[model samples]
Target: MAFRKTLLAAALALSLGVSAGPAQAEVKIGFLATLSGSGAALGQDMVDGFNLALEERGGKLGGQDIVLLKEDDQLKPDVGVQAVQKFLEKDKVDLVAGVTFSNVMMAIAKPLADAGMTFVGSNAGPAPLAGAQCNPGFFFAAWQNDGQAEVLGQFATDRKYEDVYLITPNYQSGRDQVKGFTRFYKGRISGEVYTQLGQQDYSAELLALQAANPSAVWVFLPGGMGVNFVKQYKQFGLMGKIPLLAASTVDGSTLPALGETALGVYAGTFWGPDFQNPVSQAFVAAFEKKYNRIPSQYAAQSYDSALLIDSALQKTGGKIDDKQAFRDALRAADYASVRGAYKFNVNGFPIENFYAFEVAKDAQGRVSLKTIAQPLTDHADAYAGNCKY
Candidate 1:
């Protein structure tokens, strides 16, 4: 009778959030990305990179068991909202990570802010969030949408290209890309064109560029869109005629399909496979060995995102309940980044170096991003001044 009474008492205690068992620390993480359709490779690479960091840490982050709940948003805003709702209501994740598209990020950003959940973005940084709508809970592992473009634009300007043409998809990121490029580029823009997102055909755009006869063309297409655009650009004989400068339009994920067409393509990026930093070298070697493919900037950023979380968790001694405390920890940015030294700004964005990378054959004859020069140094986003947080 005493044993029955004790069991009942324990059950009541458990139901009231008191446990007789020892408290085990666990951190739940929700990862939302576009892991379907033609752009699947990008999201898949990001996830793989994130997992590799966990593998190195023995599947634990910051001495806490990490429960990663991954969901595919299918590149849809509504679907992304649904996934974020599930993460907040059902999964009760401590952190939300991995948004590969700006639209999707926009769809879920407000909810994450409202819930005060820490958001570590692996990809897709929209401008509004970085500026006026900035949330203290958000930290971008990747640069703001305009960051890469701004670097590439500076590269074009330095190259002394007098007349340059710009092309991007007609979306939030696309508009942001144009804004970023023109911010640093002082040269005349011969033409500015916007195509449909996930557009497969670029013949019309090519014709416009040909007619414009610009000295250089800066394209902001990504994923399969980049692949198609590069192939068509080569076919149109503009590959050699007009210099091609892009922001992540040609990368490791798309290089295999691009093959010879991607050769000599200049890009502006934050990290490269051949970067000489110890942590970066380690991550690059491990990622290539495990995936049997070169990791893209997307993958690099995702990996950094994981490392960032782990660093914060360690700082807080595996306790994530205190929002401001955890936010302060993340702001420290003390971890060794694959992109070398980086520090968080007042707006929770990174102030880091941006470099120009050219597609070149490595010792193994594999296509890789070879660091050319640092175009932008310790750069901070333009919209940071407007951030309330």
Candidate 2:
């Protein structure tokens, strides 16, 4: 009777698959961004794009369920640090991603590195992180802070612009922008102005720029500052009179907000709405359909970050616990990038194409970025040589 009972129990367990143990550990990723304040739109775009990638994969990465923890830093460095602490201590996330501003990124990067956490940058690759402070555990799905401006600067030099005025907020990224431009642009700079970070009014700056009598103006203001600067530029009747060149000042999300004021502005970026690759087309289509608007470069980079993470996880067979193995998988970067043919440099920053973009009205009368030229072909950041790793 005992033997018979044992055989019956074994059959029941086999039929029900009760011998299978608990399910796999959920892969948790914490996304910290400036989800509130002036950079809110940019941060929200990134979050949307990241989530969209996960949704397309049925909320699974490498056959493991994914749990995403999102927190708002309010564009404050101290607040970003606090969020990092929570993500590390409370959420117990396997990886951390997203930092829309360089100031916040700089504040939180060391803490994450100290904890031996894997960080995939969606935006805001500060110069220090890309150079002397490069960490093996860090990977960037976005360009370094200076790359786009470097392209613009090279274009300015090629165009033979004699006197140019430069403006950026006083911050890590701003300094990087100036460094990048001065590296490529041989023109005499009329002024190198550093405004307060997140400053609303540019009237005083604009008046000063007018006095400089620059043949062209270059700006790296992003988010709300871009909107304010561009709008004021138009209001001050300086739009068509002086050529406005920029790096993140006028982009997909900001262009819509700036409307007709942003028209004819020349900018440089790694991704455009009309990028022709198959993967790029698919991402742009899905993003527009889901959000009822075109995705910005910020969104495209975040989307790529999620896909890169998925590819790496799959390569490691979902064994993210093995940090070095996971890092190696990510460094391989085997997935298709929406930016097309992207690779990581020695410093873990992207080496990719940078294009010249002109803001124009689409057939549907929406302000958008049109790829006019490829200024920087297969460009890499300047800080890679300084990286010890």
Candidate 3:
């Protein structure tokens, strides 16, 4: 009888302990981007921005211990898919963030969504994803890929540039940029060229552009491709003659390497150093002090992305297991964003202001973007009409 009583008591104690112990409350987040190769610069900037936000939040997001798994996709679709799978299956990350390339974003969107993971896009904004194939699980923290380009196009038209040459990488995002630019620009398009995506050599295309002799050149090349193109355009002595107008690439990410070559160029974007918002100013100051360089728009977007996730987690009391509640919290746009007042469109993309910016040197001998004009005031992207949910 004594032995029987002892065994029953031990079993009861074990059961009680298992039942009373607190459940694990940690949240795992996966950050996927081109952390290596040509696109590394943009990826590093994004990582820096996200880290800064995490630090500001005391290294906790949504009231839980946030674990970030960083992966390098190398700008390839297959690699990106594999990275997302690993994050979803192997690491069991609850959310995935920071995909910079549109191609890569499309490659991983469905699978990540199917896994019931929240995928927040910090940069890439492919039109198709925004339209018919839009998923509720996918949220774009950055502006639509073409919204900034539209600002540049309208600015060019306003300035009365009769003839313009447009060039972009021959990819979905690149093609969408040209389309977006043309939507607002009413001038004669002397040339519209779509070059091979990730092609380093722009000499042949530049020569062709020179032959066309357009009044101005508008381009959309991000990361190392932008750096190489700007350097080569300068070497060909086309900078002064053609009057380069760009969208978020020339001065945002490539300025550090291009130096004086990037000066006097015109770009259109949603964020800049002179945005005159308290959140933006503080972010820029903090980033510059930490990295010894001006944070690009890519960095700004990523910072916002991290903060949004953290804010959503806070709303849920740091519980990431409740997918529906988390998604609702994200849709509420409850976080303080660095981009002033940012809200999500019906399609779960950002509805923000677009600014025309000029690359200029300040009194402190630093290169930064100055606001030249505001094209879109509280604008929603064009694809919002297609979203049923």
TM-score against native, each model: 0.94, 0.95, 0.92
- Give the alpha carbon lDDT tens digit for every residue of 235-310 in model 1: 9998878999988788887998887778888999888888999999999899989989989988999999999999
lDDT of 3 by residue, 1-389 (tens): 99999888778878787533466577788999888877888888888888888888777787677788999999999999999999988998888999988899888888976777788888899888788878888888888888988988889989899999998999878988998999989899999889887779998999999899998999998888888888888899997778888875766578888888888789998888777778888998999898888889889999989888888887888877788899888988887777788788878888888888888886688777878889878877788889775
Question: In model 2, which range of ten residues has the least summed lDDT?
Answer: 17-26
Which one wins by lDDT: 2 or 3? Answer: 2
Candidate 1 TM-score to native:
0.94
Give lDDT per model, in order: 0.91, 0.91, 0.85
Residue-level lDDT of model 2, residues 241-278, one tens digit each, is 99999888888668778888899999998999888899
Question: For every model in order, what is the number of clashing pairs?
Answer: 0, 0, 3
Residue-pair clashes, model 3: 3
Question: Which regions in candidate 2 have their CA more than 4 angstroms from the true location?
Answer: 1-21
lDDT of model 2 at residue 52?
92
Whichever of 1 and 2 has more TM-score, that candidate is 2
Residue 22, candidate 2: C-alpha displacement in angstroms: 3.9
